[model samples]
Target: MSTEQNNIRFSRRNFLRTSALASGGMLVGFNLFTACKPEAKPAVDIANLNFNDFNAFIKIADNGYVTIFSPNPEIGQGVKTAMPMIIAEELDVEWDKVHVAQAKYNKKEYKRQVAGGSQSIRFGWDALRQTGATTKQMLINAAAAKWGVDANTCKASKGIITNANGDTLGYGEVVSEAAALEVPEDVTLKKPSEYTIIGKDALNVDLDNIVTGKPLFGLDYKADGMVYASVLRPPAFGQKLESFDDAETKKVNGVTDVIKFGDKVAVIGSNTWAAMKGKKALKAVWSDDQNLESTVDHNKELIKILDGKEFDTRREDGNVKKAFAEADKVLERTYDSPFLPHNCMEPMNFYANVTAEKIHLVGPIQTPQWTAGRVAQLLKRKEEEIDLEMTRMGGGFGRRLYGDFALEAAEISNLAKKPVKVVFSREDDMTDGIYRPAIKYRIAASIKDGKLTGYHLKEAAINSNMYDLIPNFFPAGCIPNYKVSTKSYKSDITTGAWRAPYTNFLAFAEQTFFDELAEELKKDPVELRLELLQNVKDSTDEKIEYSGERMENTIKLAAEKSNWKEQKEGVFKGFAAYYSHNTHVAEVAEIEMKDGLPVVKKITAAVDCGILINPTGAINQIQGGVLDGIGHAMYGDLSFENGKPSHKNFDTYRLIRMNETPQVDVHFVKNELSPTGLGEPGLPPAGGAVANAIYKALKNRLYKQPFIKELSSKKSEVLS
Candidate 1:
């Protein structure tokens, strides 16, 4: 493989559409790679041979190899492999002959290219399928013209086009002719039953590279004469730099220079070790510019907000006061989650070569377009002067969505006037990180005549609150009298999206609260949820975000698959179903008590995300999401002391170990509905399932996150 990487650029011309066709007309175009000069070929091996661009998505080489470009960033969500499979399926090409390449960011050529919210596949489905089908029809038209036959008589499959008389023409034979033909107005897409490539097991495109230790990730990227940088930022969130002394840093061997920008000092050196050593050697002073907050402060403030009358009512249906006043019984519970650092496997790093002429940025970033715009505004340069290339991320989990690291690299290079790659040590990544904000939720339910009649949810969070749509999700339309209120306590500590965002904890709180409500109503946990979903279906409200029918199916499937009602000697099961990212998922966790502690043994998940693409990848996503959810809910916690993180690395922190991981069995609901998002939906319900299972095994209710802590406290209380 070539170590020198090229800037990912696409054709600037818009896709061609004939005026004779209706709106959203068929797209036809020649090689976007050579759109400026059709006679010229790309400077590659295929340049000497015949090749053609099929609707700016696919390319066919004379050797019969097909290349499909995936436009979204690959954040270990399998969109890199799954998106191309959509194109390959409708293109009627064999999977083995197809090659997948990550496309460069070109807003004019692609839409919604960012990799967040697990929406890549959902948004790209129709356009991707249409691209492939249109290209195939154009090729068929070319073959039909060459053979003097009606296009209706031509059948294409496996890169081969056949006329009614059994005359076969390889796609490579007609790709050039297809390039000159007008795009067909309409093309038929194959039924799910007829799919050959989609809904089938396909290995990840980068699997070999990842396993064999190839340079496929941002950390592996390098350029000529690139210098390394290690930066020293404020130790605490509420502190700012007063002054810095870098005399000792300058004397360090291999250290080139030290530059101070904004509130940070960057040590530049010939290599990573020298830069890091220089950073440690430098002396700096910081002054507290604002209140130095701590976890205790956050805890007290969150609870205070929950108790305060000042609130933003997200949704309210009925008189909650009257319902609670006239109720037979009332139950209220509070759940809290601590700040969480993303802690991606690969620390934050980016390469930047900035000059007066242009700026080159190469790294793994989820929001490349947005980052590019931000960099342009920060550096006082035009957006057109920047070129960003995204590499496969080792792990994103919503961390890469922010471009602060990339911006730092660019600014440092601009100051030093040399190509620079800023590397963040594990300590920097953990301490100075954009974290998931600490949130507290209080849920109250009123029971009347042994039925759940009223529900009220209050949210208090740091910096921001949940998305407006969360209040409209499940249990919103189910309850006769429902209300959701939110309050936010602004903190200087930075926080952004973490995996499933609010639902990561919200689902746990809601699902567990439902379990408690079930007990109060003298009902089974699963049955209670089914009953609520039936209420939703019976309602005529069209504003609810979740589908009662789809949610019911997944819950039933999960319960059935896990033998929810069957009593096994040692197995205890807990069930939870949720809708998020436009996908409905239900999960059942099986656990048993060992040495007076609850140990999760297995997790069964039933997902209804419409259609399944690349079953192998889908299962991997589901299992990974489930495990991530379980690990974070049980062990993920970040504490603050004087606005500084308590733990800076894994040694001090905790994570779910390999031996602690449970077996995950994932099943999908059979449907032809267009695919939604699978990356995050599986995660929202996993925590609730596991927490409820632990309750079943221990017969104790745990309301907080990092459940191990609560469980230990419960054990200590019982002993006392």
Candidate 2:
């Protein structure tokens, strides 16, 4: 059960509305914001269901079938299902009778609707609960009034209300009367012990549509008179389009016209095949605008920055110089990781229809509001004139957060004066992607009299440094003498958020460094981390982002469940714990030697994110994060040559094969502190755990990404 501080609180002025549908149904919705009033407009019809302007999130039909609108974008993170589960639990409705729908973007109806940072549940927990509980209370009042009894004498469960006299009424029969009641200022939310839905396993609502080859994804969307377009963008970062010859492209069988905008050329046709074939036949000339950068150049530049004295100090505590000078021994290691592409299963695509009246955009977008604003600006129209709808995404992984492809679609449609859908072949998606930046970290720890005395860390990257909050994450408050600094070298290659962002690679580097520290001190790795956390638990600092007690509990649970100290014939295990995206996670990786190489066999993970919405969905997310981390650390690499990608397709690029995947076991710490992030925290500790396990199997340590290449070559030193 949640504590008093976490209870759902409401005001008498809360906006609650009820409307009688033209089809004889009732609508009930409660918006937390009291200032904004919904516009008086006609009800909209979707699939023959009437939904009013004020009841955007909930509608109860005459037959007792309920529709709940999910206000956030669905990027395969389970938010589309889990968010509605929260509402259904408090509304006391059967899960089978509920229907989930993806909501169109409406600024007045939703807040923080983007799907990134794994924060949908965390931010929506309170308001969603209030929405359902308030509606349920109104229904109870209506039932009690009908029976001439006190409201406390009525009990509501599973869309039915029963009075003390044993008279029962269905929610549909009393919904119209309930809608007329005043908004309840206080309603009790169910305790965790009484929950029948939130913590239980619930199947995805769209499972049937997904498995039956239905049109649910953005790639499956179509419209009347919509033409297909294939674009030819700059092949290299430092090059731009100087001229193009499209006479041959115009001769292709279904090609209609060719248009050029900025540094890209678009070919239009009746179908995708003709558009692509026309693009293949077109020829374009490019001219260099600056120096073409390569992977080798980036490596040299990062190393130079690390070796130089130019730096920006992010954090400092105590006297690191004094502690280092008085230490008995010092160990330093530099770890490197190459750039990575998102590599979404569905390549970049968006549909746009631009006219003098309105702009219609329909596709998979992580940031719908942001994309709507950008599309309006690019077309020089009002934001209110754009209608944006989000489709189910095959995969986002932060790629859809930037609407570059959506902008291209709108631009092409406006230039050609026809509704167009821009599609990118695998090559176009891979070469013109906002990739994860290449980074390197140099860490040094000083030991004095068998105790860790000081720590120093320096980072070098492309484009931007780590965000300001990361410098204060776990070890910052634990270490007495700690310091951190960073440097960056700008490049034309665009970089943005990818999965766990900075902590994804940072965790691997720091956890392995801690393992080396444990060896130097003759202590167990788990014991060393516990001792470090003890300091944080005793500290009085309030600015720290993670809780030491929660992280310690998570680590202990992972170790106990995985039998960290047990020894089997050829089973080697390694443990790692980290805090990121507002959640604490610990992982234990088990490996076995196969033909003189370490092969990961299984992974056990423990997480503490306060509350679990759906165990089935939560477990799937945890397992996916672990496997993604392991696969990327082992084989995911994107290299560059003269401002162009070295590999553009899966033939040259490698991903983890099915045979390489391992079984994952997950455990969650039961608590009621309110839910945090779940989609990303499980991933940060996975890479570090696997790396430590590999070192146990082999005596050598790895300092670079694509660990398979280093293992195959037997490279004992840094590869970059």
Candidate 3:
């Protein structure tokens, strides 16, 4: 969507609503949703304040204290802090003087309360700025009226308004009068040059609380008379609960009751330990009626689908067949990536109190509105009757986008006739299998006269439910005679978004292919990609999904920062670039072979997400994403045998540890463009860069994921 389409406009009727404060403070609320649209207004209990609305309220006391409510979930991506920073910047308030609070979920009031797709900032950029600017304008207008001067002559800075004569009044002193002033329709937002808070390093609002072990995360939440529950899931995919003997479970100390709902069995107890123990003792039996497919079987099915001619064409530019037939050389290869688990630090958990008339749920979730709608449908209740509260999540990577865990908690609470928190153990979380879809890509490219001629890609996967695995992504617009085809195989294994979705695998495959082509053509990998992007930039197309100039800029910046042309004694460098979520990123990896294994020494990244809201936060996000991508490419994988997961926990599965972490340096291309996404863009290029670097170091191309295993076997072969 264009920026204008995403711009939010507040009606005068709902612009600023004031309520008398007990401490003689001013309470100003800004409704973020459209007032003209009846459906946009959520049914909220004004007296009790029970709703999930995107609206924000500022509480300013006579003591110059300011509190702002952030209206999105904080899943460790730093939205809780970055969002409030945006408001504080436009409000002309000092960072230390402003406090932030989390807002509840109210769908009708909050247009988009989702965290997935890395869209929280992108979607809220204009709306949130307008919110702060509008409030600041009101305060300025009030100060001008008090001083009997024009509003334009008055200036506001650091929570203080000053008149031409040098007379000043604090925001708190004028907040009451500002609350009674009319809100302006078009408030002026500060230009990038005038920003005092944005682009500067600011401590996270929750940093102190986190370090102090405060109760902020969902796992730390508690309630009066609330019990704990643990669920026993099916042993394998396509299985249904047949029978269970809960006699021993109920007899255990602290174990209250055992309830069965469809394929899941829940054991309630006084605490989390008791519930887990009781669940283990339940010993439920399941019936496997459908086809029990394993990872081996799924791989074979994907291969078959790829070999078959039947496919859905997603994009076709030129005559690929003619180009391939007339080319001097045509190279084709297949890349495979296995299904991976999210493994959020805090296992899935949610607390719910479901009664006949209402449902109250509190937990860590990415999509509160979508989950609330699903819960309302399941319980045959109105959405207004359900209060879904979002808590700080230890990590979310997209697993919390599903509402199954919340539904399970609500079901258990309804059956127990009390408030209950459903918790999933590490074993349960790893084995349940809502994983990143295992994917295979058959890529072919034709080279003629040292110039790229044609490119073709065919993607085969288990399902296309969460995100369509597009074959033509980045290089599609850059290369001529390009074609993309897709095929899907049916499977019982559940799959959802994991970080960057399909781009995570596509970047590895496409960028690696580009590196191979560069080697074949005797050209620098970075220069070759820049040439393709240059072609894209010179094109006169009416619309382009990605900006070639931005991509080229980031690529050049990364290359410059990483000293691409210079090489250390034994260090090998590789380069990769990709565009996703409207953000362009380029990364270069430096590696050295130590003890027959490739050790990543350092990584240099350059991102073009337009203006940087928080330089420190953006850098942190890029660093985290780089590490996560490296970890997944090096050690992440999940397999199954006879429809049951082969890996039960971290013992069987592998994850990147602190010892394996590499030093990452991040830089952003300076621009005045509006800010884009940051959460997942930095990840896609990390895998590709590392894979290409390893290939350069060892001269052995690894086409499969979990590069550590493949490298180990290659090392053994070299020794033998």
TM-score attained by model 2: 0.94
Ordered from best to worst lDDT, the candidate numbers read 2, 1, 3
RMSD of 3: 4.4
lDDT of 1: 0.83
Tens-place lDDT per residue, model 2, 1-720, is 454232455665444456677776667555633322223221111111122222237787767778888877888899989989988998899999999999898766664457777777766676677777777888889889988999989989999999998999888888878767777777788877777989999988888999999998888999999999999988888678999999999999999999999989999999999999999999999986555653248888999999999999988999988998999998999999999999999998999999999999999988887788888898899999998899999888888888899999999999999999999899988999988889999999899988888999999988764456368888988888999899988887878778888788999999989988888899989989988999898678876778888989999999999999998989988888999878899999999988877788999999998878999999999899999999999899887887898889999989998999999999999898778778778888988899999888887788889889878777444454
Model 2 error, position 277 (Å) = 1.5
Per-model CA lDDT versus the true structure: 0.83, 0.84, 0.83
Candidate 2 regions with alpha-carbon error over 4 angstroms: 1-7, 12-18, 28-56, 290-296, 715-720
**637 Cα displacement, candidate 1 (Å):** 1.1
Q: After superposition, how far is residue 478 of candidate 2 from its true place, in Å?
A: 1.0
TM-score (all chains, Cα) for each model? 0.92, 0.94, 0.94
> Model 3 segments beyond 4 Å from truth?
1-54, 293-296, 466-472, 540-543, 715-720
Mind giving the per-residue lDDT tens digits that candidate 3 earns over 1-720? 123222345567665466547776677666654432335322111111123335666777767778888877788788888888888888889989998988888765565576776766765666667777778888889899999999999999999999999999988788778767777776777777888988998888889999999988889989999999999998888788899999889988999888898889999999999999999888777885655654348888889989999988887888899989999999899999999999999999999999877899999988788788888888788999999889899898878888689999988888789999999999988898478888999999998887889999988987654323354347867878888888877788888778888788889998999999899999999989888888788667643567888899999999999999997889999889988877999999999998878999899999999888888889999999999999999999887787888788998789999999999999999988878888888999999999999998889898999899888877788899
Measured with C-alpha atoms, the lDDT of residue 674 in candidate 3 is: 75
TM-score of 1: 0.92
Kindly report which residue stretches of model 1 are placed more than 4 angstroms away from their true locations once superposed.
Answer: 1-56, 289-296
Which pairs in model 1 have colliding backbones?
none
